[model samples]
Target: MKVSSMDESGKYDKANERLAQVKEEVGKVMVGQEDVIEQVLISILCDGNILLESNPGMGKTKMISTISKVLGLEFSRIQNTPDLMPSDITGTHIVDESADTTDFVFQKGPIFANMILADEINRATPKTQSALLEAMQEKQVTVGNNSYSLDDPFFLMATQNPIEQEGTYPLPEAQRDRFMMKVELDYPSLEEENKIVDRFTSELDFEPELENVISRSSLIRLQEFTRKVPIANDLREKAVNIASATREKEELDYGASPRASMNIVLASKARALIEGRNHVSEKDIKEVAKPVLRHRIGLSFQAEKQGMNEDKIIDQIIEQQ
Candidate 1:
C-alpha cells in the first residue's frame, strides 16, 4: 500500500497520533531516559538500527523488550559472545535425515524476527558481528546458495557495555556506519530512582503489560509517511552544514560522512512527525542531530588529550550552525 502526502492528509495526521500513543505505551515500562526512548523510536521511524551503550542495570534490555511487546512486533535476542559464529547468528543449514529427505535444510536463526536485541554485541568477533550487520543492512540472510528475506519492518537494537573493554572487539567504521544512531543511556534522577525502587521492590514485583499499539501495515505506512514529511530549504541546508562541518574541522581527525547528513535529515523528519507536525523545522534538526551523528564522527589525538569527544565536537558544530 503506497501512502503519500498527496494521497490523503488525514492519513498522515492519524499516523502521527498513533506514533504519539506508542510513546505513551513505552513510557509505562521505561522509567527515565526519555531521550533514549525517543531516539530509539526515531530510529525505528527512519527504518534504521541503533547501538545502545550504557552501564549495567540501566534497564536497557527491559526497555527494548517492553517496547517490542508494546509495538506487537516479533522480538528475538542473541547474547553475543566470543564463541559465537556467523552460522550461529544467522540461520544455518543442517542435513535432514528424518522423513525421506537426504538434502540440506536451512534453520532460520533469531535474525528472522521483526525486532532483534543483540546483547553485548561487541563481545562477538567481527565475523560473527557481520552476520547480524549484513542482515541489518540488506534485510536478508544468505546460507549456502539460498537467500531469505527477513520479515517486513525488521529492526535491530544492539546493546554494548561502556565500562567493559576486555576481550571486546571494537566495531570497525563500516560496521558502525550501518547504525544510524548511538544512544547512550544515563542514570535516572533522584525522584525517578525513587520511583524505580518503589516500582520494582513492590510486593507484587510483576512486569508491566504493554499493549500492541499498531499493526505492521500501519508501521510501514508511517515509515512511508515519514519520508514524505516536508522540510524547508533552510532546514535542509542546516543539516548539511552541520554534517559538512564535521569533516572540515581540524579539531577532529575523522568526521561524519554523507550518510550522516542523510540520516540527520531523515531523523529530523521523523521527529517532526512525532511532534505532531507534518513538516521539518530547525528545532527538529538540532533535536535529532547529536544522537544521529555522534557515532559517525571520529575524534583526533589532540581532541582526545583535551577531553574532547564526539559529543563535545557535535556540540561545537551545532553551536557554530
Candidate 2:
C-alpha cells in the first residue's frame, strides 16, 4: 500500500477526532483517572491486553463496559473464581440430539467476543487462568479437539484487587507478561467525586448514553495506521535500553524480557497518534515506559525487605538511562 502524506494525514486526523469522541463518551460515565482511560486506549490501539489493578468500587467494570459500547465491539464479562473451570470459559462440545446421526457439536463460549472483561481475574486458579493464554496471545481458543479462531481486533481487559489477597492466586509470570500494560486506577478527586454524587442522585434522572464513535472496521483500520506511525531509530534503541537496564540492576532478581521493549515502542506510537502527532518521540517512549514495564520485572527479596516496589525500580532505571 503506497500511503501518501496527505492520505496518511487524513486518516490520522479522522482517528484522532474519533478518539477524542471516545474519551468524551467514556468521561460521561466515568469521572477521574484520565491516565487509566488513556493507557487502555493505547493498549487497544496496539492490539494488546490490559491488566487493571485497583480496589473495589472503582467502576473498573463500568468503565470498560462503556468503552466497549463506543467501540461497537461485542463485549463479554467473565467473573473468575476458584471453581471456574476452563471448559466454562472456552465452551465445550454438547450432544447434538437434533442431528440425524448422533454427534457432538462445539459450542462457543464468552471467549469468542471482540472484547472480554475478565473481572477479578486473580480469583481464578492458575489452571483456569491458563485457559486464556492461547486466546489472549494468538486470538484462538482450543476446546475439545478443535481450535476456534476469535474475532479480529480481539482485546482483553482484566481487573484485580490489590487490597484483598486471600483466596486469590497471583497471575503467573507468563500470563503477566502477556499484558501490554498494567493500569492503576486511583480514587476520584474531590470535585470529581462530587460530580459522581450529583450524577447518581440527580432530581432529573441521568443515564450516560455512549454512541458508537467509530465502527469496528474503522477501529481495525486505525490499528493499522497506528503501526505505520514512524519511529526514529534512536528512540527504538532507547526503548530497548530501558528494558535491558533493568536486567543489569543487581537489586532485581528478574528483569523484563525483550517483549517489554516491543510494547514500549508500540504504546509510544499509539500515544503519539492520540496526541495528534504523525511520528513517535522520545518523550512518548518515556511516558509509556512505566506502565509497559512495571509488571514485567521482578523485585529481589533483598529489595522487598527494603520495601522496594516495581515502580520504584522502574523509576531508577528510567532516571539512570
Best by TM-score: 2
List candidate 1 stretches off by more than 4 Å.
1-9, 203-205
**In candidate 2, which residue ranges exceed 4 Å CA deviation?**
1-4, 203-206
Report the C-alpha lDDT of model 1 over 84-133, residue by residue, as the tens digit.
98887787888898878698888999888999999989899888988876
* Residue 247 local lDDT, model 1: 93
**TM-score of model 1 vs. true structure:** 0.94
Pairs in steric clash, model 1: none
Residue 261 displacement (Å), model 2: 0.6
How far is 255's C-alpha from truth in model 1 (Å)?
Answer: 1.2
Cα-based lDDT at residue 176, candidate 1: 89
| Residue range 84-104, candidate 2, lDDT tens digits | 999989999999989689898
Q: Which candidate is the best by lDDT?
A: 2
Structural similarity to truth (TM-score) of each candidate? 0.94, 0.96
Q: lDDT values of the candidates?
A: 0.87, 0.91
